[model samples]
Target: MPHIIYNINASPTSDAGVYPIILSGANGANYRFEYEAANLIINKAPLSGIINNCNRIYGEYNPSFSMSFTGLKNNELSPIWTKQPRFITYADKYSSVGVYPVSVSDYDAKNYTIDTIEDGTRTITPRKLVLKVNDSDRLYYQDNPTFTYTSTGFVNGDDISVLNKTPEFSTDATIYSNVGMYAVEIFGAEARNYDISYIPGNLIVNKRVLKVVADNKTRRYMTDNPVLTYTIAGFINNETENILLKRPIAQTNATILSDCGEYIIKILGAEAENYDFEYITGLLTITKIDQVIQWKQTFENIHIGDQIELLATADSGLPIEYIISGNVEEYKSGDRTYIDCLGCGEVSIRATQEGSVNYNPAMRVVKYFTISEDASIDNINSDDYSLNIYTKDGYVVNGSLSQQYIEVYDVSGNCKYHGTDKKIHVGKGIVIVRVNGRSYKLVCK
Candidate 1:
């Protein structure tokens, strides 16, 4: 962990000083802080800084220090003197916790069973059962075993049905006489005979079984979910398992009607999953023999809503995720097909584009106006005025502005203002103005 030292030098903001310096890694034990000045002795000795002068000195007050704030034995050391205009040290504690490795064991309860074996009427010796932990991480931990002849009807190699299955053994049909002192062996060292209780969630650990061995060298960790894992049959490339998508017959590439002719409809690599190759007829064939082929029934000319079967070889089993489209000679429509979306819970048929698209480009209209000079707040006596609005299509709409004030200004230091209350026609383009008393025209947009 890095020990960051925020050294607040006694000098003001004008002087050059290093404020915060981070000291980290294994070499941080030998890190030292130094304060030096030009044309003076550089302090290289490692010692904690001590305030000697009031604030400044004539020569140089260079002091180097090792981090030893914990051993502040001076009772007179003021807390305020150590804080203000002084360097401080702090080490992050969160990065110091040590991490250790742990392992877990798993078991299959269905595989093994338990049985009993007896000798005489008065049993001289009880056939004892025991469990062992062979991990070497525990020093002096021996391979201790326990008897499984307990009250829970436990037998040797019996599935651990209950906690009383420990020391689960019986002699001459007699149940456990003393239960507290006895220890029973519930699970064994076999990979499929033990269960580890460390994992959380629905414990379905299926990749590997729990084992008790002298060496815990295998890289198996405690997992939450467990499932039955098996291999797929007859697969060559490491038995590659994939998700296949089966859907209705659809087009992959759009049918482009560039010119009118007998065009053979070819199936793209993606569209072959929708149709069965062997069952389809009057369409292109996709087989191991020939991957792609022309349509059997050739269209004299391409048209919309034309059906074509796409066959894919079994080698390429899964269908590619895409829709097929084509352009017809009759209409130059976009790359979209109308279909019913059932998942929306409503009958929705719409044309959707396949790839990237650009929307329609449009132009914006900016009106520029010209104002007359004589029109102002001091001059307008009549209420009649004319307004003209025009469009890019060469259409003009006109209106009159009456009984309202018309104010205008130009870049050449000219002003025209008026009041008129009439219908005004505002249009998109260069605008012209007319005033009753003004003679000069002012361009004001």
Candidate 2:
């Protein structure tokens, strides 16, 4: 073997690098054999280490860590790691204060054996929390309302459910407390992952509200005034209208002699402790009494030359005046307010009483009386030539119908007219007039 020569003089080193190798024979002085070449490769030596444990406060990000190398072989230098191992944990910043497993992922360890990869631990500590309370108000003698608060510093979607016990609020104020400010306090809250703190608030006690009202009353003319009264509204705590330091006084400017109108009944001078009073006025109605005339007389069936006394009275104790009409005469003599009816034929008298300042006007009274039926138609002789019989009562008809022969009779069954004439004279009282087949009773004015 011609110079089974080799380039194997030196041994490989523990360092990592590439060295070239050539094995070939010198060309036997003339022709050289094809050279054989090869390369020697040295890789990095393996290393070992243990992952370090980490700690983090609750509601914070996970902290970074380092590794502890066990040793190196052949006194080799530690290799430069391109990628380091990673630690994984199920615990988050929001996790409760405790120890949690921190396992390591090799990442090939860059040829490093990560001993006790699962031996890592992450210790989480408590987070800071602030509970700030809200202010409130209440009226005097009122029950306290429920209090509330707001919190800061929660992490990883954690809320009040993360707390073992919620904070409770309280106050020294009571239903019997005076109208002034009171202290509101907070206490009793617990959570494993938090160190809680507080911001205090207050509650204000205010005065209560109430109203005083006057009662309305009414009175008639020439009558006594009614008693003025008052009522109270919005009383609390078993309080009544009698609890006022100065009770309301109700008054009005109305009297018996007042005209028919509305007057204000005012409520004034009301006082109470811890209560704001509002006064409300009422109405006082002064009205007039009704006055009426009393006359009862059905004067009927009397002969001529009859003399009758017209008598009537008034409810107002006032004298009644009488007016006579038709074929009657009236005479009022001296201070006596009496009407004398002396005449024949049909007569009517009206009695009236004018109203005074204390009384309303009386409705007039009237009565009709027939002394006798004068059958003599002296007034109709001049009007009989007219086509229509226009009597004192009214016009009878628009036009006459077929077989329209008219007859007139007096109340005493005396035939005044039996001729076929639609025109006739009706004097007074009630009379029957036959037109066609119908009979109508008419009264002359």
Candidate 3:
């Protein structure tokens, strides 16, 4: 048999298992022996203890806090002794007026766990003071003005002293005398318990002064009457007393005899109290009267037995008078007048109106006619009387007649030529000839 010896070293992390001790024979056969070791058990360390759980402090100033922890031993499972507690906060200092929650935590580096967590709160508040004052005030010039104010958040029986030196008016004396807007201030007050706030207000002072304003106008001569109007400021209207200024005097009167041109009417001697005088120059003009004349109608192409009254008009508003001459007779029926055509001849009519104060005399001439049977009569073809008329180049007629008077008329019944000669010259058109009570139609073309 062979003898064997074995030595084993074990640590805390050593594994628990069986070991073998072997002895070998020189020929072939071998023997083995085994030994077992017990398993090692380690206990966990205790958790750290929290000394301070919660706290509170003022936020207006910087706050200081300390977190103390116990039950931590110098071992592998214990908390880190060199590490300090960390604080989770939104800002470094709480200057604003509000409440804040702070968290305090301790970390263990060896055990990888949180030891303790603490919570705390901080609050900041403003000093209480309430101020009240009037927003605005109005007063007349040379009148006394005053103001008052009130406050809150003060201790009982404690008087509140305002820092405002002058509460009535502005520092400048001219501000009250002038008519304008101004600002008045109500200063803040500093007290032991609370601070009073500052406020601003407005002051309005009015002055009594008059201002006159007028508008310039234009007028027509002998047609429009001139009227003066004005606007006065800073004055009141009353029925019991007259507050208006006197009517202004005219230096030059408006007259119809002025020439047709632009003229000035100077205004003077206007007075009022507490007001300044102002006047605007006015204009007057004279113009000539317009003359209008019209002829309503003229009677033309009139035949025999045709009656008509000549019509005419004038702006002077007067009745028209007529005078008839030539181969017509004037006759009146009722209030109307007319001219009567008796024979185949032209008649001259004249319409006239007398001059008036505003219009000149007007006249018009009307020439009318009467038709004869010779206008439609065909050319006479007799041995005793032969008439032939042509109007191609010019009016020409070759005729033989034993008559003392001869007359030729166009197709429109207008007499073209009248004489006692056998040959006649007239314009180019169809014509009729009357000779010795005979009628003949002559085509002068």
Query: Candidate 2, residues 267-375: lDDT per residue as tens digits?
Result: 8887777677788999988777789898885576654323455668887887888776765445555634433222345667888888876678899998877766443
lDDT of 2: 0.68
**Index of the highest-TM-score prediction:** 2
Over 4 Å off in model 3, which ranges? 1-176, 187-192, 196-445
For residue 362, what is the lDDT in candidate 3? 67
Model 1 TM: 0.12
**TM-score of each model, in listed order:** 0.12, 0.47, 0.25
lDDT (C-alpha) at residue 252 in model 1 = 20
The TM-score of predicted model 3 comes to 0.25
**Which 10-residue span in candidate 2 carries the lowest summed lDDT?**
375-384
lDDT of each: 0.23, 0.68, 0.50
Off by over 4 Å in 1: 1-401, 411-418, 421-445
- RMSD, every candidate, angstroms: 46.4, 12.1, 18.0
Residue 438 CA displacement from its true place in model 2, Å: 50
**Can you rank all candidates by lDDT, best first?**
2, 3, 1
The Cα error of candidate 3 at residue 233, in Å, is 6.6
